[model samples]
Target: MTSDADPRFLRSREAILNAARELLLESGPTAVTHVQVAERAGVGRATVYRHWPQAEPLLVEAMATVPMPFLDKPTVPTREWLRRELTAIARQLDLDDVRAVSTTLANTALWDEDMDARRAQFAGILTTRLAAALDDAQARGEITLALASQDAAAMTIGPMYYRSTIERAPADPALIDAAVNALGTWAAG
Candidate 1:
């Protein structure tokens, strides 16, 4: 039987994926070529090719493995929940792989359909969680729903992104706290 049917095949595939993920997380998509993944996984290039026809699939898989942040409907006070979400943003920004690739993804949407799709998916997740928090705030008479929930959500995340991408700074807890306070004050108005 081909390796696909064997239990060992799963191990091999896992090794390949882990190797690709490590490289992608260290550098970016450009570092995750078939030859490199095969070398890192101790597999043959042809084997890598057989499993994944192109680098893009491997890149996608590797990126998919990176844990995206999720915040449930919170039980804590609004400010605390906002702090948690802001902290999540700060943590995500600390990922070298994400920072390396975000600029290209942000600017090259027309040419990079793959990245564009990824961005859309990420943004959708972000908007959903943010909107939920805003909904809670509105219910509590905390915020003006004068703007679209998504737009307000953008306002919440935009500063964190600015610090991550433009300011070239690390995730500071104090900064997250400040952001949370600003968001809370705005919502309270």
Candidate 2:
């Protein structure tokens, strides 16, 4: 029997995860079934079951492997920096695979406790950055936000999220500008 730490075992695990992620990105959450993953990975169904007995956990792990984009630290004015970051986020959300996996995460989280935590954790990738940026801007005396950084992150990104994930539409550029302007105004108060 191959030990867990064996190189072959690790390679197989990586293959399984890559296959599951491919299916999720290509055909959404339903395509991540053990049979599909096993077939795609060229592994036995029993192998997939051995790693993740539940499809939800399997799906979550696969989704986790999909990278969240990050921009370098701000080198421009905070508002400009925020625009660039938000624009990057909008562009990311515009991808078909991103929209599929994101919706899958949100919908699945409604029913699965583990998935819910994962969803929040995944979402923090953006919000945490947003919060940090806002805090940094405040420290620089560039803007004063009455709301907490976390709340501000949500407020700014919520529209983009809704457009891409909920409405199944691209995030409009105008919406991005509007969000930035609105946040700036809110922070100015």
TM-score of each: 0.62, 0.67
lDDT tens per residue, model 2, 1-189: 779899978988999999999998888667888899999999999988887776767777887787654544765477877888888878877876566667767888999887888888877877787788878888877777767888867787788889888787887778888887765543432
Off by over 4 Å in 1: 1-42, 45-60, 65-67, 142-146, 184-189
Question: What's the distance in Å from true for residue 34, model 2?
Answer: 10
Tens digit per residue, CA lDDT, model 1, 1-189: 466777777878899999999997786567888889999999999888878775665666687687554555665466677777778766666665456556556775557687678878767777887777777887887755666666755776777788889987876887776655554344433
Clash pairs (backbone) in predicted model 1: none
Local distance difference test, each candidate: 0.72, 0.78
Number of clashing residue pairs, candidate 1: 0
TM-score (C-alpha) between model 2 and the true structure: 0.67
The superposed Cα distance between candidate 2 and the true structure at residue 10, in angstroms, equals 8.4
